[model samples]
Target: MTYKPATQDQLLAIRANAGIAELAQSERYAAAEPDLVEAIVEGVGQFAAGEWAPLNRIGDLEGAKLENGVVRLPDGFEAAYQAYVEQGWNAIAGSAEHGGQGLPFTLACNVLENLGTANMALNLLPMLSVGAIEALEAHGTDAQKETYLPDLVSGAWSGTMNLTEPQAGSDVGALRTTAHLIEEGEHAGKYRIKGQKIYITWGEHDLAANIIHLVLARLPDAPEGSRGISLFLVPKYHLKDDGTPGARNDVRCVSLEHKLGINASPTCVMSYGDNDECIGELVGAENRGLAAMFTMMNNARINVGSQGVQIAERATQAAVAYALDRVQSARAGAEDRSPVAISEHPDVRRMLLRMRSLTEAMRGLLYYTAGQVDRGDIGEPQAKARAEVLVPMLKAWATDTGIEVASLGIQVHGGMGFVEETGAAQHWRDSRIAPIYEGTNGIQAADLVTRKLGLEDGEALQNLFADIARAAADEPQLMALAGECAAIAKWMREEASLDDRLAGSVPYTAMCAVAVSAWCLMQQYDALDDSNDADRKHAKRVTMRYFLDHIVPEAIGLKASATAGAALLYELDSSVLAA
Candidate 1:
């Protein structure tokens, strides 16, 4: 029998057991005026199938092209983008006052997963725009918000975050971009930015009439290093008071990067001040660019994590479809002339099932994390604290799992996986960026160790362990898996004794992701079993058991290595590494 996604009613019942419903009804959710959870889920399923998924290969093969300093999107992207804008998807999590749908983070995540599953490259522009919106909402003046929010939310305009410079890849302090105050009275109070930004996604595109670039630069008199940096909003084209694009802004795309994936989304080398009059308005207080950018960066990090989930889900589905149809050697009791589907083979079945289970667990973790984000914004002080602490964990684990799951999908296809036409390879290539981007999984693990571990005088880490303990304590079925999760979390706290936390951090991040995902899956199992929806209940239990038995042990090994510390990687000489 063909396997279908558990129905919405069943998913909701499963979610309820995972504490999703209670979280939705919490004060924080109410305050956000977040859309009903059911609507969000329904919208996601429809959008994934109807709008996004069909574009994956089309966008990948016919990616955006750079011509005469302008970017041209793939065929059908404009129409698909139009459909997305019309649906008001750009503003799902935007503040209500800005003509947004005012949905919660959890709902927004649901949509993002679908978007990623459909076409990650196409959705990059909107993803960046929403992060910019959040940054502006958090820090921009009323005048700026009044001027930019409506167009941004309506998708009449798009946005990008410009943070990297030639000398400053990960180190913000090394940036040399300069933002001098314009001397002319007409442009007074506006800064003229001059520098180059590299590897900027959606930096220069014609998908929208105007592109709003939130750039970071240093004032002439500002202090050195990171303290000297400041953020600005530099649009692609100057807009009239009526909000229509007018004269071209000095910013222009120098060239587009030929990347390993996401070719459909233009990654450009943007020159900010070639004309010497690129007008930019200050974002927040001076010398606080990194801090202000963090708001956008963190939001983007989570969104990127969701993208990883999307790719994994799509790839897993595609692999399963192929497995059940592709004929290979016969299974036990089958005759030589009667070859069975690849899925009939035990090894192939194991890989495909692992891919499905991991993808599901990842989705659950992302939604659960988003629920916490909603709570942090509106829940009590303690709830907010808990949510804040979980952000890094969620971001790290989900993205890492995305890479693993996508890779497993490729493995299920055998030799055909490497062929681009199969579409399996695309997922693997695209997923590679997830762990490397969004602050890198290593950076995420370092954060977990240095900051999050010692939070609340070491009580925060213990609280997380306690929650897992409590979840496992009463449920004998989950006790072993939950204990493993607790053990890994404990090892993460003790990783400080090892040298060079960053070296072994990525694997640790992946391990943590697996453990945490298992914990969340167990919660889903509890939810489904408690609900009246029998199919969903059975499905959740089976999936949870699959994850706990097969995936949880992966974390146990990772914990062993993380406990071994970063010294091994550090010992490898740069000369030897290069050789």
Candidate 2:
């Protein structure tokens, strides 16, 4: 399936709505001129479409294969990756002091959005590397950065987070991986990592020269559970005297996972220190590995949310194309009652509009959050807090939207959608894993209510609501809905029990996401108010109106359920609930 990215105008409109111009005015991002940013974004989209899009199907069908410890991707993947590296795409958001272009991280997110939409599986390799770069940049020793940052930033070597062991799913403390100090000659200072990790994405791949495995393991005589865990920089190959990749480390991919989607990207069952010589260097303070790994996980969570937007965008495009091309029954209201294309059918129109509007809103939300994160990075306290609130919503809500939109894509396809060859099924399959990973959507919602809502004693949420109300001043309907959500949030924080809060968190999250999404779309509507491009502005206007008319009310309807206490939920018999 072919992929298309947001237009330059659309991208800029999102940035404008998010107030990204403030970042450009700062000395930190002064180089991010409007035209330059637009050109770069458009160029990345073009590259994604032209290079990686072709590999989507091949990756899905061929998948990644493991043979005798080495993992391999389908043909053309390596060349496309090299093109990706050659184009300097990987260095877009890295630090200038560390071989990056020193641009806004927002633009880098845009790059990932585009590239991942084209081929999300293939994008995982570099995405993980970006997170690793972030962790090391924050915690790695100077020697570690000097040896690793150059290769990692340039995409010559990939990074993997080895957190999941077969026994430990979401519980990091349950892991049994062991690491010990090497008290020997040449490697005296380094530690040895020994254990197996499952579900390691891009754990061992042929595309990069070596894989940097960030392993979480326990040291001897340490406290048990999560506190005992320490992070290690275990590489596929040990570096030589000149800081180049040299000897093969003891780590290897014992096998590859048989997964539901993103097949081209290897999900490996990694075996570390089988020969008792998996040398690794410490990343940060001992017993604080979870903190360091969370730096990567938090980054990965947002990017995982981006997968939802990417898949939704692709699915929406596919649905729209199919709707325009596939003619079926006659439209009841048409002057000529002959059979018409599905696009002309009213119900189909609703589905298509829902897909279009929600996808656009999600795109806006992702950009808005990314832009705030950029501002927060530059010392904006409020921006940081608000971004924290938005991250869980983006991760939970957007991925849920992704699944919904992709399923709609299949529905739009009718019978053909169920078949694998149509690609609609593939989109849904790929999207299925999103909400389950990167801290499940439910976990995200719980975090929102339990943690983020309490920021500044609920003023953070109120501030956001107040902004929504201010933005919705002319639109009383949206203002009313926003108020309803605020009331629910207040009730959850002030009156509701923990059980009640947990029970209602999912609905509350969806409600807040809808309110925030409306807030985002409102910005787009405002940004396009003076646009000379008639079609673009009209599209925005209609979609905004569509969301207000069709979607916002559904969220409004969620108020009652959102406020419903945990009584009914707990009353259910366990056997019956299971049955």
Candidate 3:
């Protein structure tokens, strides 16, 4: 991309937000040792530049294919996954007892961004595996952990989440899959699963030795609807007592889906119990499968948000690179023969700067969310709650921003972005599913509205406003922006119910994200004020000024409209739809 450094003011602002600097100053990145920080960041940069960079286009082109009931990834996938395992990248946030490095999730967030920025599709397997590891660690039986986790954490095996069925997608209550108690009371504890599951990610892949399918089904004698559902661990191949693959299990891949994006990650239609004899072991308890699945679902949602960030970053880099090299129209006052890189144009610069601001700001927000996670590691009630409040916000905000940033990237490339070879078009298509999958963005908004908003009668949101206000207290310009955010927070509290409050929830959610991001950037500015890194601090100030001047006002308008209500968008006449 363009190599020009940020201006003096912009540079300073970034130093203020460095993870290490925050930790040293207070419960921040400094929570980890300096050498550890350096090592992790270096590893992330290397992985992104080395293995991931080259295979991006390769994976998208080759995608994932189904053969003999197995999903085959792109050409370089096995090698890349092996390399990731060798580097211990998959174990970054896993428990140390299970062959992991035991690093904080926040520490891993930057690495996640780099991986995604390098290639999102190829990284899907690892991401899903990590979530499965979390679920197993949190709720799996001791035997289950011993049998599954070492391979999963070591990246020797992969995992899949099975929640969707033909009749059931988001509504889990509609699930038809049945888990009948087998052999009466002899093998009564065990169940036989019978049903088809679709849209399962990393469902039946060849990238790893064995695929663990976490299937949710209902017991024969259990109550109807969601209350009767139970989680089962159904392996692709039955494991011998020695933990080796013995024979084929009853589960099989019926087909692979041809999708819009993330082509390298197989979205499968899986059939369970073709012979009506799939042995399935229970996880947690019967009728509590939804709760168990949630452990994986929540992590997946956050990872999906990171996916959005990754695509946006890639799109921005591509746009910036293209703009800097492509020569276009002459300047208004220049000689007739003179030409300039497209970036020199006013509109192009605006789009580029806007893309940069949103991307950086979103990254800043995500990292801050990570930092909160780190802070939660300190083991305090308030710290834990603070981290909880940010999770849903981060999940919703970053993914939505991903969609917006990627679309803007397409705009920057003009018509070329729509074509196949440019690589810009693929980002747009790939990012579309992030919001829809991993709990739709609408679900995220509802979560923020219903759960996060009402925390302690809105005290959590109130405290959030206080933090924003504190960050902007020194500058009059930013103070106005902070006040606007605070006013919106007030409106949120005044709104009657969850549904009513979320009437304009999309913009309101965006407003919260952008406001918090600006706060983080401002905090970075505060931290760097005393630093010797003059250039870094200067660039930061300019960037911050630009954000406050050009960007914060839009958030102001969003807050106003969110407070106003959503009749216009919702109340349109049915006759208008006929056209």
Candidate 4:
């Protein structure tokens, strides 16, 4: 069954968990009145359902294709993208100075959650564009901003990040792409860029009139490694004096990757300066490309976290719909012992509840993280540091949870889920890439323990644990979970070796993420009062109870794995370990 966008109620509920009301209080988002935000939410949900959801299966089955140096999306994919642009959905979170609606980035996160749930593959296009906006906004020169920001913010021209190469996936410093100063020509003072970038999302798509490639390349006389690389804006087409796309540039999509899923979004092998004519301009200060790229990367990281909630919501919905419809063997409690829906079975109910509760928790994590980003933007004290601390773990934890929930979704379907026609497997396949995208979840874990933990001398994480512990103090399990994580954080900081920290990072990240998620649920639970509708409060109670009772306990039980040093992992030699 094709799943539409998550319901308005669910999106609104998750937004509440993120404290949309609090965001509106900020001068940055003062114009985002409650009614306006609600209307946007409702409209985005409807658009996702009516347009994007229908293409999910089509895109998966047909995928995007490479032809004649251009990447062609599946049928209706072009129109859907155009519709997305035409609807101004892309502009919501953008800045007003650049033709955007100036809404909160948190709201945009909610919007993408719906679009991603509807169609993750197609959704990758604009998601990258938004990241580019953040990058240029922070680093673009006045001329660069005047030239590119409006179109990108308006979505008439899309954007992409080009970092990975054949040999340089995680190591940006190892990239072979090079940029040369164009000292004496019409394009003098610009650059001639040359390199092949693989796994470039939306690199050569025909959805927009132009694609602005934010590429990392080293220059002559540059230092070795990442510190030497610079950010360059390479356009697929040269801009006319009038600012519209003009002549075609030398860049082309050499080939498209055949992936396990999200096939509708072209993962291009983009070659720049095939004819030695590709031109680019510097973005920020020389040799500070990594700093500029991290702006987009960090933005993309948080966006990637939402992919977890997207797939989980879709998978959970599909699983529940199937469970409620597929009749199975007789239930002992059924009248006359007649056959009952699979949902009535004890194990099935447990899986369904687990799916729902985890989805809720992940959804909360996504919103809360995005809200932190917004808070940071508005200059809220400590918000920026906390967002840095949260982004890595949120990416690592949420994507892993998405995979878990998607797998459980398949399990809920029993035999039918193994077959593609049922569409359950696609969610699993589509979801498999989130952990690998942005940065591998392993990298996210490493960042969480290393740099993020060291932020403000670890005061940021200390602040986060304090809030969670305060909110969760009444619940012994949650309080213990918080305390254990606090103790572990301290141990990792002062005593554990780097290897030990890395070994324990994944489990430790899962612990903090779940504890934080539980804290979010607890906050929501506490906010309810007698004036709230019974059904609303009851559903919240059940979801929170299930998470606290089942999921929190399982996460809390990871103490041993989290604190276990790296010695055991390295005890066996590489040969034996591989063998």
Clashes of each: 4, 0, 19, 0
Give RMSD to native, each candidate. Answer: 3.0, 1.4, 3.5, 1.4
The candidate with the higher lDDT, 1 or 2, is 2
Model 2 misplacement above 4 A: 573-579
Model 1 C-alpha lDDT per residue in residues 1-579, reported as the tens digit of each score: 122332363245226423455665665455332245665666766765677667778888988898988788877788888888888877777777888877576667666666767788887878889888988998999999999998898787899989888888878789989998876798888999999998888998777878999999999889989988899999988888787889998999989989888878899999988979899999999999888998877668778877767777778888989898899877977666578899989988888878778777877767666666666676455555665556677677877777788888888888899888788888888877777766877778788766766677667666766676677665443455445545655655664553545555656656556656667877667655556877767876777788877677766666566656666766889999999
Ranking by TM-score: 4, 2, 1, 3
lDDT of each residue in 152-207, candidate 4, tens digit only = 99899999999999998899899999999998969999999999999999898788
> Model 3 misses residue 448 by how many Å?
0.9
What are the runs in model 1 whose C-alpha is more than 4 Å off? 1-14, 17-20, 23-28, 31-35, 333-337, 474-500, 530-533, 570-573, 576-579
Which stretches of candidate 3 lie above 4 Å from their native place? 1-31, 183-188, 335-337, 475-495, 530-533, 566-579
lDDT of 3: 0.75
lDDT of 3 by residue, 405-495 (tens): 8888888888888887788888888888888887777777777766777677767777877778777776565566666655666666675
- Candidate 1, residue 233: Cα displacement in angstroms equals 0.5
**CA lDDT, every prediction?**
0.75, 0.87, 0.75, 0.88
Off by over 4 Å in 4: 2-4, 7-15, 333-335
Point out the higher-scoring one by TM-score: 2 or 3.
2
Error of 2 at 479 (Å): 1.4
